[model samples]
Target: MSSNIRIIRICQQCGNEFEARKTTSKTCSDNCAKKAYKARQRSTNVQTSAEQTLQIKLKPIEDIKAQEFLTVNESAMLIRISRRSLYRLNERGELPFVKLNRRTVIRRSDIDRLFDRPAELMEKSRPEPVALADCYTMKEIREKYDISEKALYELIHRHEIPKQYSSIYAYVPKYRIDQLLSNPSNLS
Candidate 1:
């Protein structure tokens, strides 16, 4: 006995014509409200399921396990490195590989060995530089040292880094950068 007045209105929950007892009434009955709520939950669940399926399909390539032999592309994907890097490794005789017809295949064992090696050992295995002076550019030194242009200029002025001027570009000596990199504590 909430009210005797019958206000004609549409049930918002079910989109049907119904007589509402009050002006603020949305659904014709409590059952229709519950039905609408259940429908919303079902739609949300379906959307979530579709999103999860898409995520699964776009998962990172590193999740794949290594096999006995892998193509150049597959090896790059598994290692999470560029194919050009793998090709360079193969060219330098650093990473042993096999040629199967026209395709280049890398052994899983070799990839494992490469991954398992210590970073220091791996770095040492690379070819020696032609000269220490040719190591880093001015921009590289600034970035690696995390110093501003003004600070870099100050350092260059104080340390007197033997720079080679080429039109608008100035190249910093690699030995000086190597010194700072090797002894980060020396930077003031």
Candidate 2:
């Protein structure tokens, strides 16, 4: 059940004439086939790279910048913020927007005006370090409260007791430990 039909084709890679039984044949030898496959892979990769460059990175910035008003998604993309955060800003009335026929439109000028007069932020000063003499070591806390070192650490961690480490020794303010452990209700 074989028809004696021979198809003549040119190698897609090296331009050599070849005889094949199938019309889909493109290359004369295995070497030509490998070369053709590599060329096609390279072409596909170059095309994919070009498509990514054209669509994802460069084109959006140009299109977004050209518009006077932007949607929530476009505004978030332009500012490099999350859509949820932008929506929260709108909810807080921090970022103003206009509604036109059920469309949430943010003006470009409004977005630019956000940093016009930046709020004066003040930094809080750190508290003075507690003197090591005024604090109780882990051994002292354990001896005074009749508790194990492990239990002392767990208590300090659970109550967020400000314990400072100095080299090999850890210290907790005597007053803080006294206030925390002195409370009978805390034990309950």
Candidate 3:
């Protein structure tokens, strides 16, 4: 019978030098091998997590099919308007829509009709332009200046900007807005 020869090796997990009975022994003990296996599994999980994150970041937009209806949020995103505005328009019955199993959806054709009006039809429906002396509402001013409601109110209270009562709502004079734009120092 041939004599068994032992091999000297270093443990891959614990970094300890030991005599291995088998040539394929990677760790000094079973405990070290289990720990090494767990570490490898943890590293694999981390790599998969990073890969999933990258996939989400590079995800493509879904294609819109013909004759497909869209949800309120989807319609809002497509039309570049806020969800609240879309909801308001739907509630006012200005936009054609349908309810399906408690979900409200607008037809793609209806949205297309809103923007795809004929030039003659649009000209016929357009209202007359307002005079320059007409004051603008606080909402209009906020949108025009891109300022917060609080800031606009503060400016109005400080007398830096002037406003007039229009029966129901207070309106800021257009001349004051023009003055502010002409002299930017008045904003502070």
Candidate maximizing lDDT: 2
Model 1, C-alpha of 96: deviation from truth (Å): 1.6
By TM-score rank, best first, the candidates go 1, 3, 2
**TM-score to native of every candidate shown:** 0.36, 0.34, 0.35
Per-model RMSD to reference: 15.5, 13.9, 13.5
Give the CA lDDT, 0 to 100, for residue 129 in model 2.
Answer: 63
Q: What is the C-alpha local distance difference test score of candidate 3?
A: 0.70
Per residue, candidate 2 scores C-alpha lDDT tens digits across 1-188 of 25666688888888988997577888899898898899899999999999976775555677988899988877888889998778655533456768899998999878777556445421122234699998998899778777766566657756656556688776888988888878755533
lDDT of the structure predicted as candidate 1:
0.71
Candidate 3, 9-44: lDDT as tens digits: 999998999889788999999999999999999999
lDDT score for residue 70 of model 3: 82
For all candidates in order, the CA lDDT equals 0.71, 0.75, 0.70
- TM-score for model 2? 0.34
Q: Give the range where candidate 1 is weakest over 10 consecutive residues by summed lDDT.
A: 126-135
True-vs-predicted CA distance for residue 9, candidate 3, Å = 0.9
Give the poorly placed runs of model 2, Cα more than 4 Å off.
Answer: 1-58, 121-188
